[model samples]
Target: MSRVTLAQWQMLAAVVEHGGFSRAAEAVHKSPSTLNHAVHKLEEQLGVAVLEPVGRQVRLTEAGELLLRRARQLLENADALEDVASRLAEGLEAEIVLAIDQIFPPDALARSLDAFSEAFPHVRVQLHETVLHGGVEMLEDGQVDLLVSGLSARGFLGEPLVTVRFIAVAHPEHALHRLDRELDLRDLEQHRQLVVRDSAQRQSLDSGWLKAEQRWTVSHLDTSIGMLERNLGFAWVPETRIRPALEAGRLKPLPLTAGGVREIPLQIIHRDQDRAGPATRAMAEQLRTSVAACAGTRNFENIE
Candidate 1:
């Protein structure tokens, strides 16, 4: 194994970054002679000249440029390792369990998860895509560390996150849109209404159901959207989830004179905020920030 140390690479990088050993030493709180010796020793150990003096400044040699480029990755990994260790010392959760309702904005959810992965790379994540009371059940049973839902738990309070608007829509060829005028609840009851099944085993909800004579229940939102796109039924879907379909004319709004659009205010709930670990709290923060950042891009609004 090579005897070169991370400190040696760091000193070499500092010398290159600060133009010379003297400035690098001042920046790193080290003596100029010490920084100079570290770089010299690193070059000697590697048997490669890592720096070339030019007038009063120093620059990396060609070989040094290539080596340092790879070394930077190593330095970053080492820094991340230390950060993980520090978080673990502060009681970071080994794994975070998150339950989010399916109606939540897909783009915002993805952005939150992407940011969470960057901040806690080593922490495992368990994401449960739920519907209606499904996430509430997990929060009530202590199965999830965090919950993002439109419904509220009995005891646990939730901070308002975003308001998701639902639009009554169906395929362009569906009977509902063929009416070609402002529809009403009476007209919808005659058609098949697609409904996403509530995932809670014990206490489920029939949210957004219009009590149509012909009702089809599916397990997931995607399934309902698939059926809606195929002219199988009409249902109210979140605007964010079906924006592309609406924009592309794959789906047409029911054009109801009233209740054509509905809104659900979702909130971020913590299992135990006081005892939540750093990773869990960070995940929650990312979710909030992600939704806030998406407000400008998407049609959703923050629940003030």
Candidate 2:
């Protein structure tokens, strides 16, 4: 079929919404006659009767319904394209959609956001907190502009940016605190390891010790923290995630084996189809810098 005319699509969409040519035409500032003629032209082009007059208002025929759906999509896409082009011409400024993993600290989030706002004051930024099963694929699909995902089993073709550490943590009053800073696997195994439920992102833990003990299994990272507080079980949580607690003497680090260590590397991921928009690229770089600042640069060598 021939491509839809912009005028006809506009007339069709307007009529569908307004239920009358006179109203639609007035809304679009076109003469009622002109709008009526445009719809007729569309019907002739499609070789189908498009509009059917109801008792007082008008409704779409089968072809009209289909055309209306397609017309709305086309007009929406056109508007998006036009806006992108306009933003590009003015400067590297457009609405940015960024996704961040929930593990990152909310306070640190402000610093990265501040940098973006200061750099691109004109551009709008929308931030979403994505946990596992989050919008990481959205970045790959171009539904999201950028994502702040940590290293995982699969590669996103992203650059090696930041490195994180997993530490053996327990409540201060727990039996493990009597030991030194250097943690051994035996001590970790002695206590039940409170693992977070449904969080596959941190599945790289070496739980040989826990399996030996056959201890209790709990859910929720925070709940695990609570369990640790109540001397329920020992947990190996991300160092970056529980750093404050460890420092405040609320939680104590029990020495664990270096071999069981795991590192989470943060990266910027974008789609092949997406031409990295300026706003997106800028924010992605800022995230890279922020993540690196929190954790050191990727130390893949240390990871076993």
For all candidates in order, the CA lDDT equals 0.90, 0.66
Please report how far candidate 2 places residue 274 from its true position, in Å.
Answer: 5.5
Per-residue lDDT value at 240 in model 1: 85
Candidate 2 versus the native: TM-score? 0.52
Q: What local lDDT does model 1 show for residue 143?
A: 99
Off by over 4 Å in 2: 1-94, 105-108, 121-124, 131-135, 140-142, 152-155, 178-190, 197-232, 257-261, 272-274, 292-304
Clashing pairs in 2: 182-255, 183-255, 183-256, 184-255
Estimate, for each residue in 1-304, the C-alpha lDDT of model 1 and write its tens digit. 7688999889888989999988999999999999889988988988999899999999999999999999999999999899878888889888999999999898889999999998788999999999988999999999999999999899998999988888899999988777788898899899999999999999988887888999999999999999998899999989888888988999988889899888899999999999999889999999999888888884554222
lDDT of 2 by residue, 174-219 (tens): 7767665566667666767675443234333333236637465544
The candidate maximizing TM-score is 1
lDDT minimum window of 10 residues, candidate 2 = 295-304
Error of 2 at 118 (Å): 2.3
Q: Which stretches of candidate 1 lie over 4 Å from their true place?
A: 52-59, 92-95, 107-125, 180-189, 201-206, 209-215, 255-259, 282-298, 301-304
TM-score of each: 0.79, 0.52
